[model samples]
Target: MSTERFVIIGNGPAANEAATTLRQRAPQSGITVFGKETTRSYKPHLLPDVVAGRLDAEKIFASPEDYYNERDIQLRLGQKVVQVDFNKYQVILEHREVVSFDGLIIATGGKPRIPEPLEVFEDVMMTLKTTEDARLWIDRLARVDSVLMIGGDLTSLSLTRALINIGKKVFFIIDAESFWPLPFNERLHQEIHARLREKGVDVSSSRKIKRLTQLSDCSIQVETDCADFEVGIVGAFFGLVPDVRFLARSGLDIDRGILVDENLQTRFRNVFAAGDCAQVYNPVIRDYWVSIGYDNARTLGRIAALNMLGGMIAAQASPESIFSLNGVQVNTSWWMEF
Candidate 1:
């Protein structure tokens, strides 16, 4: 007969460290959270140093906003959970509002695989993965001069060192000729591809973009059997997809993720799934993946809040776990000498 009220949906970093470890180990439990990003949950790898301006925007907030209201929790910003009924535990939001729970922690995090004929809004394509898409690619990298980037991982070398330290001009594609393949190995991808082509970043690597279209004066046309350029910005990366569409018609077992086991439980009970969209059981790549990061979303939001307080937890976070990768890259003739 649990009556804890610890709802938590997702605000990233494992739903704010599993609502501060379930409010400091169930201190009368009543966590709340909910957030679909209006704020708080920052540190999405510091949105590439706030788009390489070198971290500002309140130092990528993980706190402050009254630090989750002085820890009483109750964050709810922007909302957007869309449904989880689970017989009657309730969750439904996207304006309809329903939220009632004894222990629901989905920790919703994930969504940035924008493909599908690359939706419009020309003036050069982009997709950096939040912080409002890196502040709209830091205002389209100060109105570009040249920048192609397609994907080589580590966010295309940190957006190719923030567009070669803001001097723009930075093409880079990758279908994989090398770089971070299943976790960097071909000699650390030829030593980070020869230190990113000795800091100039034109690195293509096996190429493969196929189509992107947007000309008519706004610039950005990317084809690629080997080349077709015309950029001002095209940054693609294309990797990351798991918002789970509110458990897609909710049957509750979901394969590539939300499968849960070793207690993080979710064949639908008190209901629980953790950050990066829970595809648990990746004992260092053993399989059953799904990991988006933020310390595996605070270690799967503290093992789905200690198995939602029954205390039979195990998921110490897995799947491609990265911890640090430091940054820096430049080219286009030392852009601005930084």
Candidate 2:
């Protein structure tokens, strides 16, 4: 009999956890993980430390190469999975390579969102989503004295402090739309503004960004509804959206994200999804919702793997938690605490 084959799409915490679980349960099964990133799986929450020069980029990987080799898990880094043919049970790569799988897990995670107004300037806008993004900021910071952040998400808040600690002026524009999945209220906005001001950040009163012009000197001229500023760099922190664009027309139900049942399995039994890219069904609410944060992603990944191995395990909804940054309550993951 041929050994069972498993394929995981993604290289973040969720993907790593799923791969580990599969290896543990089905020892004889062939496991393969495809990651779009060239580097090993690392903690994205620690990206601020990388930008601040407090942590070395090399030390960020959660699992070394030996981990996969020892487990006989094939880790294909820098390979993007462009599509999945659920009917044929095949995973298609960008270069048109197709691999058959008995079981599959999609944990592609999320990508940084660029606001509509600033979409044209995406080439010049900086974001902190991947290791490469962090390294880019580290290289660019030496030439930059100040950074203009267009949105104030949890990542933007963390990066704001990191830049300030490095003696770089941070101009923050608070955009309520950027704080998706996290409920944003006027009181919360005021508290965030107050905390940022106390931290020596230039918190802007305007929330709407009207225009962004790339200057000849490689700087950006930002024009908000009520203010204008020229800064050495412009960072867009409009939060993340599901990175499942490639899954379109693949015949999976996708609304905001890939829709899954309580078992973390898609409509197809052999196919499952976890992490930020999945919008899980809530029996109680009679609706679907996406669970953000590291712990939740790991938990979902494990459950998805178990169910794939014939264990019927329903994923529990993770409670919303707030991280306190100097008495300011910010809704985010625990790892986000600086």
For each candidate, what is the lDDT? 0.68, 0.84
Q: How many clashes show up per model? A: 2, 0
Specify the poorest-scoring 10-residue window by lDDT in model 1.
328-337
| Clash number for candidate 2 | 0
Instruction: Score residue 168 of candidate 2 by CA lDDT.
Output: 96
How do the predictions measure up, each by TM-score? 0.33, 0.93
Q: Candidate 2 lDDT, tens digit per residue, 95-183?
A: 89999999999999999998777788898789999998998898889887999887877788888888999999888888887765456
Candidate 1 residue 197 C-alpha distance from true site, Å: 14
Q: Largest TM-score belongs to which candidate? A: 2
The C-alpha RMSD in Å for every predicted model, in order, reads 17.0, 3.8
Error of 1 at 27 (Å): 3.0
Instruction: Report the C-alpha lDDT of model 1 over 228-298, residue by residue, as the tens digit.
Output: 87887787665555688778777788764577765567788777888667766544544454555566568
